[model samples]
Target chain A: MSRHRTTRQRGSSANMLMTASASAGDDHSDSAQDPLPSWNEGATKQAIIDFVADVTREDSPHFEPRDRRIAVFDNDGTLWVEQPMYAQMDFALEELRKVLPLHPEWRDRQPFKAAIEADFETLLKEGARNLQILVGALYAGTTPDQFDRLAAEWLAAAVHPRFERRYTELVYQPMREVMAYFRANGFKTFIVTGGGAEFVRAFAEQTYDAPPEEVIGSGIITRFESRDGRADLYRFADVDFVDEGPGKPVGIESHIGRRPIAAFGNSDGDLEMLEYTTGASGRRLGLIVRHTDAAREYAYDKGSPVGHLERALEGASSNGWIIADMRRDWRVIFPFDGA
Target chain B: MSRHRTTRQRGSSANMLMTASASAGDDHSDSAQDPLPSWNEGATKQAIIDFVADVTREDSPHFEPRDRRIAVFDNDGTLWVEQPMYAQMDFALEELRKVLPLHPEWRDRQPFKAAIEADFETLLKEGARNLQILVGALYAGTTPDQFDRLAAEWLAAAVHPRFERRYTELVYQPMREVMAYFRANGFKTFIVTGGGAEFVRAFAEQTYDAPPEEVIGSGIITRFESRDGRADLYRFADVDFVDEGPGKPVGIESHIGRRPIAAFGNSDGDLEMLEYTTGASGRRLGLIVRHTDAAREYAYDKGSPVGHLERALEGASSNGWIIADMRRDWRVIFPFDGA
Candidate 1:
């Protein structure tokens, strides 16, 4: 059996010693004294503090190097707005419109038919499998370079319908700050979600400063070949791997090789990742963003349609996962607001 | 098509640089450096000098942050001896003896039968395919933690048959210096090879200062499960990906994202990786270790049973690859001899 380090006291803040000082321009500088400045003093804030303190203090014996401090996050609700439908679904619908003339048969296909006809409710009913079909049709049979260029173009112009902001700007400001904070502290941050890895990787570096290599999401199969005396990696129509539920930890192990010291999620889909992280040997932290503010954001957990949060909420307390009360814990929801 | 950078001209004192540098180290260091240090003043040294200088110069137009300058290396012939047979083959042979009692049927199997009878010639005739079976038998069905421990034990004690020294000690000292130099310059170095990723990863950190996350190699199938209420990654008998040739570029793209500005290799297997690196639209360098010395290091290429060099040699001149002439370049070959 792998050696398991003893867990530290649950709420102890004594072990929070700073390792490398944050460089200038750190997002946390505005509220460095509080450590959890942007977060309200609550269960979520306390859990973060306790975990960080334990892992950072060398004297406490839980200290790990900055390199080993990997932290993975789910994108949709945890990082940005997921309500009204996934942003990628919107892009897929638009793409289908543009490509329909070339592939007239797609107009009659089940999911593609729903997508091309703008029957989003029907598309939603078709669920994840339909989404996979849409992604495979849109992304496959192109070189990775070509796919990247296409994704970048889509992200540049695609605006959220409800927010009327570029999809890039729709990212949650608090989560963005959290990412920056983790990075500044030497944590190798990664985005592991059910979203298409290639799609997210195209703009992730520009939007989050997390490079494509660090993003582990659902992936399509790729083949290598030389075309015109140059090597190209071409995406195939088949799904190679999916990053959801049990697949989350599998993806992490396969790609990153290290168990994350911390994990952040918003729904039950991420519960497995949280379980894996918190159940790891050393100091561990798991945070669940509870969307509880209807005025600023959609507020529903067990009843939410987009990112259903049932098991995650029910097990948060017992599993020592911090369920962030979105209405209270977050001072700001999106970057545009001056909270 | 991907942009390709022109190969930089070698420094005027390229030959002097390697020779002079070789004499500066201890006896073992000199021995290691002598094999390749005095190489004829040519494109190889120039590539090394130009790339190093550009990366080191803060004022250089092509300068990158030291931290972003990552370099990956293949282990076997690139770092140490791969003659007689691959190093892992030696380990497998020893493991066969240990596991023979448990698998009595091996005595009747063709390749295993020969292996049990100490018929090394028959094992060689069965060739690469036979080795694969041996590797799977020796490495499969163990927990990652268990494999790590076993690998560590073998690495610590296993010695090269001809050299009669620990396999770890056979690593070229000049390469060791390169690793340190890269680290000192703030580059995060990694090992990406066709060899078993986990096997190399188990000892790379202790021997090369490359942490587990930084090491990327051919991966085995792994499963994530709760064992005794603790999560662990279990190694399975299946191969996940073979990180060789074109797979090198794919692996790097998937794992590191950014193209490495510099790359080093010893054989044709690394040609695709070097091509990928030098093809990036920036200052880049590619160096190949040509085993030209039969007296000191048993040098043979093309028809050689180990690490053949056919297409790589043909492409070296046109592709602007620096071929390290082992016989002329270095004053010594191993770390044990004085410069």
Candidate 2:
């Protein structure tokens, strides 16, 4: 029951990506031209292009001044598939299992043991914090470089259970084009998420072209220590900052030192970010990605365990935030799945 | 007794900036041709060019792959004068006096009384936290927009006592040129300072061409709230993150998400950032501004009150960090004052 549903959502999952590939290979060399081919040229797509054009045009009243054209995107749901489980949570669970041989003590720990043994019911009973704990374990004492390498290796190999493609590949092609579109128009794109900052940073450049500094998210503490006459920063097993809900705006002010001109997010966790971003004085944009595609990707919104979307779904229209219906707005759900 | 001295140090304070204006008005065409005209042709200047050229060249083995090219700089002495107290501290002190009428209670408060009365000895006795407390007052209840306005206005009018020029004008012409040089060569320049992040961010784009997002510095805690349907973030009187000494590296990682390929600093606070940046794998560059121009700019190193530079002075040559001698190497000490 999306507010907008059309032929864009009619295609089956099997030919989704292949269809996109065929179009992408044909004369899409110009950076500014054909930026959103994965998009079905609907009102949503037109709105984004029009906004960017207004801001970048020299004579336009909506022209974003120097140091003001910041674009922020939420990870997990907005940019990629975050159904059944968040890809990051899935990663953390896998990492916990891999280290079971070294952490025998984890076998006796409740959350760790449940996670290691794949006890989904007990893990679910423990609630969302179980994911944080697993993430902490994933960090532990690994040097930042080591962590990056580990994440890269895992992302390259790990495949989604349902889609049978790497989680990295599940990032929506339409959204990816949107990011590039922003970049081409002089907006600096940043990833503001509740997921681990370092974890997202590991593959942000490769997956989204957003390098480390451009990616802001939840992160644990880090301490600098010199060993063998060389300095290495070690990750601590404690939360330093969280980038969800209200924290998203705080994170933006703290790290980037400016209010973003536009923001993209999904779920209640992103509501505050959407409000904060679009609420700014000048012309601003706030977009919520409503996951409504079941054939191409998992679809769930209100009351779902992962990436619950009740608040945003209700507030999007009233807030004048554009609702990106995954099934209706996007031509393709994932990189591998075409329209 | 000084380590390096030349005719550049002989000029009295009055003529420092006058000499710089003569060359600045000249046609300095070409990005690479006259990058750092304020810098006397020396090994320090050449080292910077060589490192940038090698890393930026696609064919070179030392070429940085992807978009990992980052350059970080400490603001205080590295980019601007830290002598006669930091510019940010001075702003906080001024704000304290201006607000004394509203908060008459500050007249009895220990540190606040000292700051309002211009009791430098008493303020110094109260230590660094005194400045932070005053800064919290400067930020208290003021929205981000209001804060930006106040900071911008203050910087526009605030004049350096000795130079008799706006504080914004005190930024090093040589360093500014270097930042432009970096930008010209596809490098993103960032001001990684121990100064208040918001304070520095207010003028960073105007003075350094480093946008607000590109500026990283120390910060206090902030809370998000909405009033009159307008959401604004409030600064709290508590430590959030410090960007000094070892904290610089952590700040860099947290904000930028990667190690910088090049870093510039002055004094002991920047030693860790210097080590962190230069110590990264592949070709790297680290340069420390040595304040030795006594007549043109206030000179202090190793044991002076502010910006003491002892450990870094000893480690510079050994660590292969270039020492930019203010007296001998800089043709101009400030934008107004030339060698």
lDDT per residue, candidate 2, A1-339, as tens digits?
001100101112212223345433212223344667788878898788778777877788988753467889999888887877777778888777777788888888878877777765576453345666677766878778888888888888888898888887878888877776675565667899888888888777667656577788888778889877668898877767777878889999988887888999888888888888888677888898888878877678766767878887788887788878878888766766653
Kindly give the number of clashing pairs for every candidate. 18, 10
Query: How big is the positional error of residue B89 in model 1, measured in Å on the Cα after superposition?
Result: 3.0
RMSD of 1: 7.5
Error of 2 at B73 (Å): 0.8
Give the C-alpha lDDT of model 2.
Answer: 0.75
Best by the lDDT measure: 2
Residues B1-339, candidate 2: write the lDDT tens digits.
Answer: 001100001112212223344432212223335666778888888888788778877788998743567889999888898778888878988877777788888899977888777776676442344666678766777776678788888888888888888887888878877776675565667898888788888887656655677788887788788877677687777757778888899989888877898999987888899999988779999899988888988788866646878898788887899988888888876665553
What Cα-based lDDT does every candidate model obtain?
Answer: 0.69, 0.75
Instruction: Return the TM-score for candidate 1, rounded to 2 decimals.
Output: 0.82
